[model samples]
Target: MPATSALRKAKLTVTISGDVINEIDEIAKEKGNPRSQVMEEILRDWLLKSKKMAIEKDIEAYYISLTENEKKENREWSMIATESAKRTWND
Candidate 1:
């Protein structure tokens, strides 16, 4: 797919465990945000962190906390290749 075609956005519905749902509701109340707004903020944070935003300290700590399986063992290109293949093919 072209970049634009690859970037379609839509609403999604997911079923969460009761405990998780309750926690989300509690956080929404505490933050004074609707559930959808809270979800959007959380998703925005995840995207920013994934893309290695300006928060180097947080990103560094995040990298440091990775499990062995999560770290790259080879050069950057090889890691990118492996990750691309993994992302393109589930299981």
Candidate 2:
């Protein structure tokens, strides 16, 4: 869930360079909306993407933590299954 909900709005203070502010304003104009709304939507999208990336990193770390023998066994079993399947469906 997002920190800011429909019924819950929080104040935030952000400092950006003038160029960035102008870019945001330009995007807001292009989208026919206020700069604040554009910034909020962009920030929300970034937050969601950052969360997904963090989750992926954690998953990779977990995969790396598996025992070496376990990984080897899993790979060997997978290859055997692939070979068996190919043999059963010979062209």
Top model number, TM-score: 2
Model 1 weakest lDDT span, ten residues long: 68-77
RMSD, model 1, all Cα superposed?
15.4
Q: For residues 16-85, could you state the per-residue lDDT of candidate 2 as single tens digits?
A: 9999999999999999998879999999999999999999999999879989998999899999999999
Backbone clash numbers for all candidates listed = 0, 0
**Model 2 alpha-carbon drift over 4 Å, by segment:** 1-6, 76-91
Candidates' C-alpha lDDT: 0.82, 0.91
- TM-score for every candidate vs. truth? 0.44, 0.68
lDDT of 1 by residue, 1-91 (tens): 5798657766889887999779889999999999987887888889988667657878789889977766655356687998999999986
In model 1, which runs have C-alpha deviations exceeding 4 angstroms? Answer: 1-9, 53-91
